[model samples]
Target: MGHVILVTGGARSGKSSHAEARVAALPGERVYIATARPEDDEMRARIAHHIARRGPGWLTLEEPFDLAGALDRTDGRGPRLVDCLTLWLANLMFADRDWSPEADLLIAALARQNSPVVLVSNEVGMGIVPENALARAFRDAQGWLNQRVAAMANEVEFVVAGLPLRLK
Candidate 1:
């Protein structure tokens, strides 16, 4: 089985950078499974920045909902990095889909992976409770998703200010 690593932190905490480094350090070709959709200009710019930072040595797959399917398709190809699971959860919620089943599928897929998988996620529950119900729901779901992934992961790192603190 492939080694599973989860890197999570607050916004702009360098989780993606750390996850990228972890995947790059692994053997075989590198695959980056991006879940972000360029729905607006700001998001488009962020996606571009990420693409530029990653450079040219990785195969990129844009799968916003079917992450489990993406992992299955790319299994054994190389080390795979799933950047920002929080965005994926948002995508699912916005689409009116239940996130738990998808999360379950993701965990199962990770267990079956033959190449290493490094996942990047945001820690959304650290801040004060949001005033809006939707925001609160998203925060709660994100926390649950992160915990589920961390439990399945062989290694877990919490990044803050560009530094990674191993949690598992």
Candidate 2:
């Protein structure tokens, strides 16, 4: 079984950087599973910047959804980093897709992974509650997802102001 790491924090809180650093310290080839979909020019540029930051050393897997399927296909032969599950969650919500089954499948897949896996997510519940139902629903789903992953993770870290505080 593979070791699971969960890195979560507010936006721009250095969660991705901390998660990448953890993966970099681990042995084996790195596979970055990007879950962001560039729907606009700004988003496209942001994605480009992220890809450039990782450079040529790591293999990139552009998985906007179907995270469990992507994990299954990768075979978990090397260290894998799934950055920003929050975006994946948003994708699911916006598409009116059921996210629970996929989240469960991902948990099962993580338990069976043959190599180390690091997951990054955003902790969005610390702010004021959203006035809209859809936003509230998304917030609830995100919190649920994070809690589930954190429970199963071998290590969990919360990042704030570029500092990581280990929770498990």
Candidate 3:
């Protein structure tokens, strides 16, 4: 079985950078599964920044909602990095889709992976709850997803200010 590492942090907490550094140290073909969808100019610019930082060596796959499908497609690759589950969850919520099934699929898939897998997710429960229902739902889902991933992950790291603190 492959090693599963879960990295959690707030926005701009350097989770992606930490995950990339970890993947860079591992052997095999690097696969980066980016879940962010560039729907606006600012988002597009942020995506570009991350892409530029990743350079050309890693194979990039953009799958906003079908994370399990992306993982299945990357079979036999060296290490795989799922850049942010929080965004993936947002995509699902935005599309009015039930996220529980997809979250289960992701967890099961990660459990059976044979190569190194690093999953980056936002730690959304640290802030105050939103007044609206949608935001509250997203926050709850993110917290649940993080808990599930952390439970299955061999290592859990919380990134803060570009530094990683191992939590599990």
Which structure among the candidates has the greatest lDDT?
1
Residue 140 in model 2: lDDT: 94
Regarding lDDT, does 2 or 3 come out ahead? Answer: 3
Residue 130 of model 2 has an lDDT of 89
TM-score of each: 0.98, 0.96, 0.97
Q: Which ten residues in a row have the lowest lDDT in candidate 2?
A: 68-77
Candidate 1 clash figure, as a count: 0
What overall lDDT goes with each candidate model?
0.94, 0.89, 0.90
What tens digits encode model 2's per-residue C-alpha lDDT throughout 1-168? 788999999988988888988988988888899999989998899789788777787988899888877777776567899987999999988999998988998899888888889999998898898899999999999999999999999999999999999999
Candidate 1: regions farther than 4 A off:
none
Preferred candidate (lDDT higher): 1 or 2: 1
Ranking by lDDT: 1, 3, 2
**RMSD list, candidates in order:** 0.6, 1.1, 0.9
Pairs of colliding residues, candidate 1: none
Expressed as tens digits, the lDDT of each residue in 40-149 for candidate 1 is: 99999999999999999999999999999999999988999998799999999999999999999999999999989999999988788999999999999999999999
lDDT by residue for model 3 (1-168), tens: 689999999899999999999999999999999999899999999999999999989998899988878887787789999988988999999898999999999988887778889999998887777999888988999999899989989999999999999899
